[model samples]
Target: MRTHKYRTTDVAVDGGTLHAGVWEPVETIEGAEVPTALLIHGITASHLAWPFVVAQLPDHRVIAPDLRGRGGSHAVAGRSSMRAHAADMQALLDACGAESAAVVGHSMGAFVAVVLADTAPDRVTRLVLVDGGLPFDVPAMPDLEPEEVVNAILGPTAERLSKRFADVEEYLAFWRAHPAFQESWSREVEQYFAYDLVPVGSSLRPATSLETTIEDMLDLNTGSTLTDALARVAGPHAVRDAGQPSVLFYTVPRGLQNEVPGLYPPGYVEGLLAQHPVLEHHRFEELNHYSVVMTERGAAVLGGPLREAITERPAAVG
Candidate 1:
């Protein structure tokens, strides 16, 4: 196993301090420049989500941040939107002195990555979107409230945000019972869940704010920011430019609960790729949404593609 140094830093952004996790390469040449890769986590997750992925990337400097409404930045005062998250990323890059980086995002972070690439194309060298970034084919319903929509999409994951646990172990117990993590559970996974707890009087609640999650969930699914951003990068002219970043998208076969037709179903993905043509698609057969970036096996499978994206030059796709 390759070991790396890890530390947390608070970066100043538009709203308030944003907490980020930085992992340095175990060995570095005296005068050579080390490449940087930015990893962004999901809606209700923290920077801890990248530990397994970071282990797979021993040759690069890895930085992962708790999005505005999640993890240690739960108290960051602002409405959680794709643009807001992208702005925070821009500030994080500046603070770390990383002029350009290979950007990788999972879940909602992928949406933010798309927005960042659109808003600041010069800062992104390439994009690797893990199980997100593209729009989902959700059924249109005009009568549904935002919370109802979130509940329908996220199911028990969103429900857990409202419930309180007796302690950290209690929270761990809850996650242990989840179908997604039963086979992939490890000490790293335990640490990831443990770090998610904060005291709520006598009990502990997940640090992610329910209101913020609902706002972000609804925005990403229904808002125009992602739609507009995707149009700019997925368009023909953008893909024809060798100077523009290339995009790689990975999808899983199962979802949060080990159910088939994961976030991006097979048919949906085929149609999406057919439409965009710019996105290169890869599928992980056995992994689900959570394990794709959080488990050792999943990280091992993803390491090669990530390394290629970080070191290879951008090429025209269409």
Candidate 2:
């Protein structure tokens, strides 16, 4: 049985309108301000990817938006950069009347979360980075071409943007065969895939724009804003109030596929954790890149740590 409810709202951003999916609890506290959490989806995803996580957070209001070029916000014009995404987030928060929020981002959304915190630290109170936030060790691969890097990193996800399906069911068939879903399929996955389809001519295509996908992917690897944010979040600088803000990162052992390793390169995350005391990491051996947050079990497991972060204050970093 469905127990949660979500609302769709639009806000005027710098370039165009931004569409958001906001989930509210079944019951509310009397007169008290509801704490909001900004849930950011991956590059090729929308707010629908978070139904399971939203289900887990009954007390806190979850505000999720289609970041510029996907879902209901796919038509939003202008540039789609991390900084632009961050500014849109600020506008969404303002529209929601939330002065601050616990920022939760998945995949590329995690990248935007870090940028949001770095660009506007005051707006963010705590962070939960699910399989993203830090740079993905692109520096280590000096020999690979830029396109090769994106292809290597994104793989089938990037390829699916151009493919057309006869119907949403056809799209579901494609995903059912995917290794990630073969073992752990659910209604949440179906809803997420159905929302991914947008009508194009007589057929249906993914709501995500191919140009937006490649542009964002390239920027994530080369963008100065992301690395700058990471440096601020990681390094002790004059910019921040305390040291690093409390961070809890959940990652998977395998990549989107069987042979590929998870997004973060080998030994990369450990080095980053070593430098930043406030950044705590958890590695899920049984889950893959997609299953880490997509599956129900993943969300239930992720929820325990996530709930603690929501209520618990950041331990002071020395």
Candidate 3:
């Protein structure tokens, strides 16, 4: 087994102080001068979600922060949203002394990367989004009440607020059996769930709340959040113009749990991808949403296409 060493730090950002995990490359690859990258986890996840990727990018310094209300840093002063999360990332980057670094985000973290690139373009040299880019295409989730949304965020493994499991083995078993994780099982997959919770009383609970999840889902300008951000990445655009420059989008052929089985329509991602002229889309034949981020193979499949895109960053344009 490969042991990964990381440091934990807390820093104040837009709304509150956040917990972050930092890992320096154990080995260096020739010609890869860049020493840093930020790993942003998806909704209901924390810094632990990026271990496989962090291990792969041994040449780059990696910083993984548990967004404001998830993972090790669950407490926050106020509600959480994409904008707030983006600002938190900026604070993390600044604290790490990273002037410019490549950023990789999965799921909701992918959306946060878009907002970060849009709001603080100078901080990011390149951006890689895994299974996230466009806004929620399922329309307002009126039928899904606030409590229902919260339940999903906690999952079945969570025990209470701000605390998770200390027993890594037990937690791993719970995660392996989860319907969302059924398709993804690997060492990285086990680690992904192991890091998401902190022990509380006799059980474990997620660091983030359903309220936080609901706020992000409803308040994050779902309509134009991604469309606008992608356009900025592509370059200058008129107020009325839509679409981004040099953006690469990757999607799984089958939607994740809520997206297709529980939430979005099958045609939603296809329709969204069509709007962006510069996006490079790759389709995975069998993987679902969670598996794409939870397993090593999932990350490899994503990293291959994304690496190609970064190497071919769009030419400088007026």
Candidate 4:
């Protein structure tokens, strides 16, 4: 297997400096162009969430960013929304000198990827939406506020944002006992969690901002940006264009807690495929939502499909 060199760089964006992680293949041809893959992490996750997947792609340059309001970019000044996030991604691409890339996103990151493709179509070559991008079938509750909705959807994941830990080990212990990582635990996972902590007075807190997360979730679940973007790229009209980049959607059977019927339920996803045949669906029955991109097993299963997307040639137009 080929090895890679990893580094972190600061990308200038609208609100402030965005932090990004880049992985380059150790060996490259003297004059050949190397393809780039941009991986977006889920809500409340850092760029570290992608190291496992990065290991599986040895030939392409992989770029993963901590979105404006998360991880090292948490202090970025602005209202967090899908469109804003997309703009940051565009800036990151420019900073990396990539004209276009094979984009892969997990959870909320998938939503950002869709908007980036629609708003800046030329910057995206292909898309792999892992466990995100499609709208959820959330029931209407006119009486509920946005925070209530976020709490309901994210549960403990969102609550953790407001927590303060005594140290990195304390935070690590919390995740070590989580149901999602109980069976998939590893040293890499520990490092990912430790990177999430930021100093706050006498305590350390997760770098993700609660207000930003709430704003983003509200936009993703209730705003029209994603809905319109999905239509333009994967809707009936867009499907007719052979020049559009190929899109692949992968889903797992379980969710954050290893519960059945994951983020995209089987029947619901089938209906989505029926409505938008342009999207190709792949299912991994053994993994859950978190593991689908964070675990070695999940990354191994995705290596083949991701490589195919990266190297695939566009179909010849008639």
Candidate 5:
């Protein structure tokens, strides 16, 4: 069973139509304004990635949109920079009449959320960054190429997409075989897969264009304007991560596990928390990157620590 019902549509933003999905509260509490939440997914993922979180955020209207070129908003094209994605988020908020809302983001979406908060602090009432933000504190090796960082790990899956499969089932067979899906996938994740692909010329291709993927990698690493954007935010904030199945950086296969004692690096969220004294950090010791946002544990991660972080803010001075 789902936590809340959702609506889907095309929203005009930044000169093009972007696909957006929204889930709102079925019931409102007394004297509460019915908060709104804007969820931004990571690279290559769409609004579908948020079902688990949306279920728990039932009291607040939850909104998740395919940032520019992913999912149902495939026809749109852009440079795939985080700034552009942030701008699209702003427009989405405007269209929904949410002058300000709680912003929740995962992976690359976290990068955008930081940028949005930085760029338009007035427009964001609160922020929750999941498994991202605060750069990985690792040294760059001389031999490492940029592609090694972006495509190498998922290279097999990307290449296999070109092959013709009998149907979605066959494709899913190949997809499930990938190491990324080894642990387990839920029904929502399966539905996410269904919505992520579109049939083109008898072959099912992921809705995101290759250009969008490539350009995002380019923008995030070298031209990433987010670090500066995150610096400007001074408001209610929270950062959370699953402590197990570590997410990190290194040169070897399964390097994340071998790299360090922590999932990220020392001071990973420390710097941001230091800057914003109000920022709260919650680390779930048993979950991993994906499950941190997809499972029941994820709901608790948001509801217990994160929800308190946002709602417990001190009253503003007159």
Candidate 6:
């Protein structure tokens, strides 16, 4: 029942403006030292994706941004890469005057958070990756073209980018019919869906750029920056990199459809965590990928762990 109040603003970045959602708590915490966390949304998503999560974390300041070439910045022109996205995060923090913040990313955003934490460690205090990171279990097929690779993994998301809807309402209807959000509809959901629409000629289409999305998809799979970031986070080259850090990674048992296995295939997360031994993970059997922030229950679960990640001390060196 927390009605989080927030303001929408745009900040100058490398290519174009990044539309951001800045949420402030209704009540002040005991200490004036406010902890800030940056929430990054998934592919084909916008800053609006974190409204429910913001509502739950009333004590913390949440900064969610519409990654370039999505939502309000749909026309943002730039080469999309995980490294570029991570740098934008640093610039965003500077613009917002936050010296450091916990970086949390959902889905593709998780990969960006990992890159940010590794590439710009001074600006990132912690990392919370929701439903992403550690890499998706994409098969290694040398014969498949990059486009083919993207289409195979992205599924409906890749197709939806180009499919134009008759109107905003029609686009919202499409989302309503989606298996992920079909059972979890609300005003907030509708608002988020509404923000996804953009006028294309006479028709309407999703605000995200299909090409940018595909490029990012490719980066998530084979980008060198991403691989390097993961290595550094796991203590590869740093001297005091003792294979530990304040990282929280959460995953839902079900996929976007609430039927498939999940974004992180079985054994993928466990093996990666075993190697890194720093990422604190929480798995939810009932929550789907989209509902992790879209639904109340999902937000509640995320809010609790997210609060601890931001305010609590890192686990004692073991």
Q: Quote the positional error of residue 68 for candidate 6 in Å.
A: 0.4
lDDT of 5 by residue, 1-318 (tens): 556777987788764799899887777778878777888887778998887777776677888999988887777765778888988998888888888777777767887887887777667766777766545444543365655545553355345434565567876776566444556466777788778788787778777766677677666666438656654443333222332111111111122122233335435556545664444566555455566675555566656655554454422110
Candidate 4 per-residue lDDT, tens place, 1-318, comes to 646899999988887999999999888888998889999999899999998899888888999999988889988998999999999999999999998888899999999999998898888888889999898656775588877888877878888988999999899989988889999998888889999989999999999978988899889877588889998878877764555455788898888888787778888998999877778899988899899888999999988888887678733111
- Residue 232, candidate 1: Cα error in Å is 0.5
Give candidate 5's TM-score.
0.80
Error of 2 at 143 (Å): 6.9
Q: How does candidate 1 score on lDDT?
A: 0.87
Off by over 4 Å in 6: 1-3, 29-31, 235-245, 314-318
Q: In candidate 3, what are the lDDT values of residues 141-218, reduced to their tens digit?
A: 556766554444334423333345557776677666667677667766666666666656887666576667768765
- How far off is residue 169 in model 3, in Å? 6.3
**Candidate 4 pairs with clashing backbones:** none
lDDT by residue for model 1 over 1-318, one digit each (tens)? 566899999999877899999999989889998888899999899999999999887878999999997788888997889999999999999999999888999988999999998898888887889998998656775688888888887889999999999988889999999999989999999999999988889999999978998889878877588878888877554565545446899999998788988889988998988777688899989999999999999998888888877778843222
Location of the lowest summed lDDT over 10 successive residues in candidate 1: 236-245
> Tens digits of per-residue lDDT for model 6 on 50-146?
8888886777788988898888877677789888888888888888888888778999999888888887777777778898877776678668887
- Clash pairs, candidate 6, are none
After superposing candidate 2, which stretches have Cα over 4 Å from the reference?
A: 1-3, 137-147, 236-245, 258-260, 314-318
List where candidate 4 sits over 4 angstroms from the true fold. Answer: 241-244, 314-318
Off by over 4 Å in 3: 1-5, 29-32, 139-145, 148-173, 199-203, 221-245, 258-267, 311-318
> Lowest lDDT 10-mer window, candidate 4?
309-318
Residue 166 CA displacement from its true place in model 6, Å: 0.8
lDDT of 3: 0.67
Worst 10 residues of 2 by lDDT: 236-245
Better of 4 and 5 by TM-score: 4
Per-candidate TM vs. native? 0.96, 0.91, 0.78, 0.96, 0.80, 0.93
